[model samples]
Target: MNRRTLLTAAATGVAAASLPSMAAASPAMTVKDTMNRTALYRSSARTQLAALRWGSTTARGLLEQVLAHQAEVNPGVNALATLDVAGARAAANRADQYLARTGRTLGPLHGLPMTVKDALETAGLRTTCGSPDLADHVPGKDADVIALLRQAGAVIVGKSNVPPLCQDLQTSNPIFGTTSNPFSPAHTAGGSSGGPAAAVATGMSALEVGSDLAGSLRLPAAYCGVYALRTSRGSSPIVPTRGHIPRPPGWLTSSDMLTLGPIARDADDLDLLLDVLAAPAPADRRAWRIDLPEPVSRTLDGQRIGVWADDAYCRVDTSTRDVLEQVTREVRAAGAVLDESSRPVDFAASNILFQKLMYATSAATAPDAVFQGEVKAADAVTEDSPSALYLKSRTMRHRDWAKADEERQKLRAAWDAYFETHDLLITPAAPTAAVPDQSSVPAPERYITVDGVRRSFYDQTSWINLASPVGLPSLVMPAGKTRDGLPLAIQIIGPYLADRSVIAAAKALAKLLPTPPKAPGLMA
Candidate 1:
């Protein structure tokens, strides 16, 4: 799509980004009876279940242990916005009973505990949507995805924290307070999924649900040394039964470009959660029900990867670059083939197209600043005729958004073509390590280094944007820590609806890389 057309088409933006589980005696368990540890501490959701099965432990016991640990540690991390201990336990008990009576498993998540971002409503819980305005608002029914997970036998442990209105990367709200990075207390835990990422990194939960419009999920994963997946737009069920978006008569209900997906310490668990979360909702919820195709790889031999780490618009930070280099080297060392040199193919152009559309997203989200910028920028191009639909959509109009909708389709087509040649694209998750806490992050504030060069913190959303607009899938996994002990990770962007391929690739890379360290005093 042409630059003007793309900008004209967008008047948009998108969502929280992630939450956990327990110790069982069976294969997925790794607990120690002697030390009261069951191979469960800091174990991946996938591995924990494996240890439980191996140890012949009960799922109910594992769920209890996981829940107990989260309650115990959350006092320090401040991750949960609302935890439903009684309800979660009741659900866990039912899952165990079902296993005994029917001898049939609900799904991969049977007895596993998970947390959804507060932006997703869970019936009877406070679905604050990360805003003080709705701090005490409770929902009467679960969100479509929440219902799917409940049916899959996963326990809804709690609701996770997001920045107020999910408008920023720092996860803080007047109602729930702030969530700090387990690595450095002074650094923000990338939001609005910061609470979930921090919880996952600290071994407080097994898997988390977070949304990302412009790096909401990816940034937290990068900042917290965890893995997050942003599925292709609409690929997962997002029934608004509990009303995440309380729209008036003519307003839009949640942005269509963003998606809700799972965050985990392992790729396998991501797939497991995706299965539960992405299924079709019941008949009444069909408008947003999407059919996600099966995973691309049954084996790793033919899996082609296109890797890009930097671009001219925003330079990847030192620690970020360092980790990406290591990821590239490690993937090459493994059986995977590298595309070529360090150049990110057409990243400058990709980012340019992304920025306009992004501003549209922010415009709807933050309203004043985002739309004001668009109006100001639209003024900059003095000679051309622009659509009133675009201007009105940015400012006043709500419906008849068809013109911008067509523009987004063109961009999606371009990205679809790009992904046809590559199974997955690899890049940095964020441009820098965690930013300092308590400092207001001006949208234009760059991640400046000791060398005195300014780089956009908004650029941190570049990699995720590649996947967001076209609704392509992206997976994030921690690579290693920086010299100063900050976290570093990479995003594996996959083709549309190719969510499984991204997770599988992340899993493969994670095995070859160093394991994420347990946060200090957070996970023991």
Candidate 2:
């Protein structure tokens, strides 16, 4: 997912189910998601749409519920920045009118409400992008995904918050303060999509659209104990780039990494949204009526899975590791053959090269008037210092980026080889579990805390790069929680573009895991 505006992209809440259930209470992979009434915060596009049809709630009614909830709890949790009561009400009213006049539907998302990330424009609504400069800017056209959702009848609820230019993993900007994790308000909801995560985790809305470049979407999902899909890069309709973007066509193929998809409460719900978003742009495949491919696994009965809980490059918090271990054990006990073997993958080099290409992509270019930041940084560089490396990388020559590209191909090839023997792989989504806010930390120093403990600010990207570089689909699902009650998650990665198969595996594995604990923040 492209979490930052640099990629110019695409872009949930919660409540309880009041429906009666005769099904046995057990680990709800999708069932707990559909049945949990304590308000576990993240919303599923599938669940929301189903509720609209089955519960007689209009778009306006759902918006009213979130607005009312926000009024009572937003001050305590700090999730929303801008709420589009009027715009959302207007959209909801239109949906209600449609339902009244015509039994026919607008699309799959009729009457669903989604809180959009502010980085993407929402016509007629302010899109601040967490920058003071964009605090009042409003584009005439909606982002591609927004228009698609609208066609499907998703009411725009208003803009969520982000970090400035989405330069940090923690969400905090001069315009919007910070988004705290619902599990523990002092910790983060994870950025640059934190606000949406916080909002969804607090039961504010049912679904959210967020982007991820460097684990933004997945990290937030993990911390919030929700399900998030970071699809193979370019799976969703690509958004146009803005200022600082260079190169012909002004389109970015940044490491061919990063993605945009859905964040919900379970695997099936996550798939429901992913399918709707996967429709090729109207111009591209609507005319041809493209169909989605099935999941890679024949069935979960005897599937072969490769799992890596931790690695030498990054240390997973014990809780996160434990959750995955349990998931692996459960899957095995359920009859799937689990492989603890390491495949022929270049994780260390993949990450190192990814860093070079990623930062270069971020520092892509500047206009004549705004070249000051680059000039100052160049002048500030001392011989052979880290700044010099940055300067050299920033102005990356074709040969330099090509070198990284070659390495990327090698990594992709390595993945191809690995997949020949295994159908799927699982690992920790991030090294830590919603650590203290890191907004004030410098990029380089971000990896090394002021306390002198070394950690990779980019470490979260380690496992993410595997899926991204190869353009593979990865699903992040809650494995369980920590002794302290924090959420822990695992990533299920499938062959590039084999999304359906990954969904099947997650559903089967979900049946094996323990019942995830109910969150404590549902009271709000």
TM-score for each candidate, following the candidate numbering = 0.80, 0.84
Per residue, candidate 2 scores C-alpha lDDT tens digits across 356-427 of: 777676664456544556656766787678567666566666897988878877887788788888888988
Q: Which stretches of candidate 2 lie over 4 Å from their true place?
A: 1-45, 234-256, 282-290, 368-384, 441-454, 518-524
TM-score of decoy 1: 0.80
**For residue 112, what is the lDDT in candidate 2?**
75
Lowest lDDT 10-mer window, candidate 1?
10-19
Q: Quote model 2's TM-score.
A: 0.84
